[model samples]
Target: MEAFAVPGLPEFETGDDIATAIEAACDLRGDDVLCVASTIVSKVEGRTATLADYPAGPRAREIAARFEEQTGEERDPRFAQAVLEESTDLVMDEPFLLTETRFGHVGVNAGIDRSNTGGAELLLLPKRPSESARRIRERLSVDASVVVTDTSGRPFRHGQTGVAIGWAGMPASRDWRGETDRDGHELEVTVESVVDELAATANLVSGEGDDGTPAVVVRDWTFGDHEGSENLYRSVEGDFVRQALREWHYEQ
Candidate 1:
């Protein structure tokens, strides 16, 4: 399969149409998977915000003060308030703000972007990424799958890679469980995250900082005969790492 970015996409505005913009820029096939940067999706969805928009309450002020005292970096109470407002649960709050967004996404500072905000102070993620992907897919002329992607740091990973926060017209993963391996042994537990892998491939050509190519088309790639599954995020009840973190006390 080959992947290339769609060129000539302009700086998106609040009311811009992403589906039409991408459709005009390139010809997409039904089999092609379109990976879109969440930044552009949030831009067009008008998820931009300013720090002043969130008034720092007592809780926000406390969190900010504790953050500054522990990290030795000044923390803004309004910024803390913004993260708090965007999150439904705080996974971690000491060294950094690791929280679960409203739509089940877990990320630092609620995955708020400070860059490429179209002059706004912040760029919040789309309220519902899968819904955003579905909307974009329905607007397209062809039946292409859409993956709404974002770059994020992962546990035990040194740098950030593209991850699928929302997807449409396709399953999230290819389940390899119960399949035979190279040695003819039954594979008990193996699931390939197709959307995240496609998102990473898209990012290889999507460009960063000023590349202006936030959308990429991946052609000729197929899911083959593997069974598909839509299980990406882990539930707290089954997530041992999260459980340990919740029970373990921090030194600081």
Candidate 2:
């Protein structure tokens, strides 16, 4: 599969037609999957907040104080407040607050992005990324899939990598549960996150900083019809990491 950036997109704003802009910049084809950066999706959806919008509250100040003590860097109380407001739960307090977002995504700062946005503004993840992708796909004439992506740091990993936050027109995972492996061993748990793989591959062209290419078209990929990114999340009851972290936090 080949992924190429969709060029010539102007700085997007609230209410801008993303599908039209993408079609104008690239030669869209049937069966192509479009990997769109979540930042642009947030921008177009008007999901932005200024520092003034998130004044430091009691919880924000408490978290900020702990964060600063651990990092040795002054934490912006307003930023901390915004992170808390965007999160459903604060899973950690030191290093950085690992938060579970309203949409059930766990990450630092609830994926509230400060980079690439104009100064003094922060971009939140789209309220419903799968819905956003589906809308974009419906607006375009070509039969294609859409995957909304964001850069995220993995546990124990040094660098950030692209991950799929929302998707439409394709299964987020490919399950090989009943299939046999090369050694004829039945694959009980061998699901592949095809959406995330596509997002990471698309990021090869859509760089992290100043790339200006927020969207990419991936060609020559096969996918089954599926909707949403819910499959990408591990259920809370089954998440061993979360359970262990909760226990560790109580011990501390």
Please report the candidate that would top lDDT against the real structure: 1
In angstroms, the error of model 1 at 146 is 0.2
Model 1 regions lying over 4 Å from their true place = none
Best by TM-score: 1
lDDT tens digits, residue span 1-252, model 2: 788999889998999999989998999998999999999999989898898998899988987888777668898888989988888877776667788887777888899998987452899899878899999999998988999999999887799999998898887888766777789998776678998999999888899999799999999888654322348877679999888776664221
How high is the lDDT of residue 202 in model 1?
92
Score candidate 2 by lDDT: 0.86
TM-score of each: 0.97, 0.93
- Candidate 1: tens digits of C-alpha lDDT, residues 221-242: 9988889998888888988877
TM-score of 2: 0.93
